[model samples]
Target: MPEPVTLRPRGGMIIAAIALVIAAAALVFIAIDGGLLDLARWAWPVVLLGWGAWLLYLRPYVRVSEGFVEISNLVRTYRVPWGDIDSVDSRFALTIRTRGGRVIRAWAAPAPGARQALSTQRADVTHTPGDDDTRRPSDAEGTASGDAAGLVRRELERHRREGTAAVGQTALTWHPLLIAGTTALAAAAVVSLVLPHG
Candidate 1:
């Protein structure tokens, strides 16, 4: 079997990390300057930054293995077998349509802009028809969605041709860490608002 393929947005992750650092610094500054009360007042913006970090850095990944494709898009992880995937679409993001008529979107691989998409198409045409491209085409990480989508579609086709369909159940798993973090943030915000200043 080939090595597992992981698809994620390279640029977004870096940007998110930078933003997270900046937000954390601001949080620390606020807490230090005026205590918890001042920090609490501006917590909403910090919370928004955290959510952005969660979306860009923590969540949204696609792992395509020989057996199945595991997609974690923010809150839930979807596991779908190769046989169940009808098609992989890249209209906005990487979306998978299952033979069972279920649609799953991958948050990690965002669709490229029009200019980037065009350049990718040009790149595809420039390659010799007979010469195979060694690199796995990706949409979110500087690679175009068209190439990434085509690669995935071809993989699915190859799996079908080889009769490699296994009995895999389509499952969705929630991210407990994300849920707990959100809950904690909300609780802190509420406590800050409700309790009188000491």
Candidate 2:
């Protein structure tokens, strides 16, 4: 069996983490300089920064294994078996439609530019078979989402032909720990805002 493919927004996540670190450092400096006494004034912006950090760094990812595709967003993770997948589309989002009429979007892999997608599709159709020597890199052919979607399509097709079984029965589940952690962080942020500053 081939190794699973883990797909996430590489550049955006890195940038968001860097921004969060800078924001946090600045916050610390302000606190040491006695600017925290006026924390209420800038608290909301800090909250916004935290939210952005979570959205960018924590929100979405897709793991495609031989038998299943796991799509995780903020609170929920959907594990769809290859056999259950009706189709995969990359219109507004990287959407997977199940045979039972369930449509789940992968938050991690957002759609690429439409023009780029179209051009890549054209290239694939026009390119001759057994032309690996002439083929361009995956980056040149499509966006990250497009590349991910293609990978998923290939795996699903392979599994469909071989009649692969589901790895586990459960699907469309949430990570309780992640939910609790994020909730706690949000509550703390809110509490700090309402509480009096010393």
Candidate 3:
């Protein structure tokens, strides 16, 4: 069995979240030093925003194992077996189309921005997996979605080449902790804004 490949945490996202957290901590310190809990209340959104940054950017990933592709999106995750996948696409993001016609997008791998797309020339896309005659910017070499889709496509092709008749169903699941935390933090932020903090 080939080793599984995972596109895990994005360093840029992690650094940005850390910066937000630091800013929130500074606000909290000011509130403590001044004995002003009201000021602390104003920091709720900042703290939540820090957590939100991590939730949206750092939490998502795409993992390609010998038998399956796991897509950990923002609030939901999907484990689609090789047998279930019809194709891997990178139109707007890295997406998996199942034999049953369900399409799953991976939030971790998104298309390049307009500037990046404009910079990608025909010379750069020579080795990309899809049709060269008609390729989206998402299929460009340096883009996140393009790279991830390449890995997924290669793995799928290898499965076909090896005659590995893998069998399984596609499973969908929600990120319970993410959902709960976001709800709790959003509520806290709202309360901090409306409730009288003395």
lDDT for 145 in candidate 1 is 50
Q: Mind giving the per-residue lDDT tens digits that candidate 1 earns over 110-157?
A: 677667655554354344211234322333334435444655666777
Model 1 residue 33 CA deviation in Å: 2.8
Clashes of each: 0, 0, 0
| Backbone clash pairs in model 1 (N, Cα, C under 3 Å; residues 3+ apart or in different chains), count | 0
Candidate 3 C-alpha lDDT tens digits along 127-147: 887777767777877678888
Ranking by TM-score: 3, 1, 2
- Cα misplacement distance, residue 149 of candidate 2 (Å): 0.7
lDDT computed for candidate 2: 0.68
What C-alpha lDDT do the candidate models reach, one value each? 0.70, 0.68, 0.81
- Best-fitting candidate, scored by TM-score: 3
Off by over 4 Å in 2: 35-48, 113-140, 165-170, 195-198
TM-score of every candidate: 0.73, 0.72, 0.87
- List ranges where model 3 is wrong by over 4 Å: 8-15, 18-21, 35-40
Best by lDDT: 3
Tens digit of lDDT per residue, candidate 2, span 1-198?
A: 578878887666887788788778767766777565655444555756766676665577889987788898878999988777887776556778888888897778776555655556445523322234433323232455656666777677777677784544438787798777767766767777787665
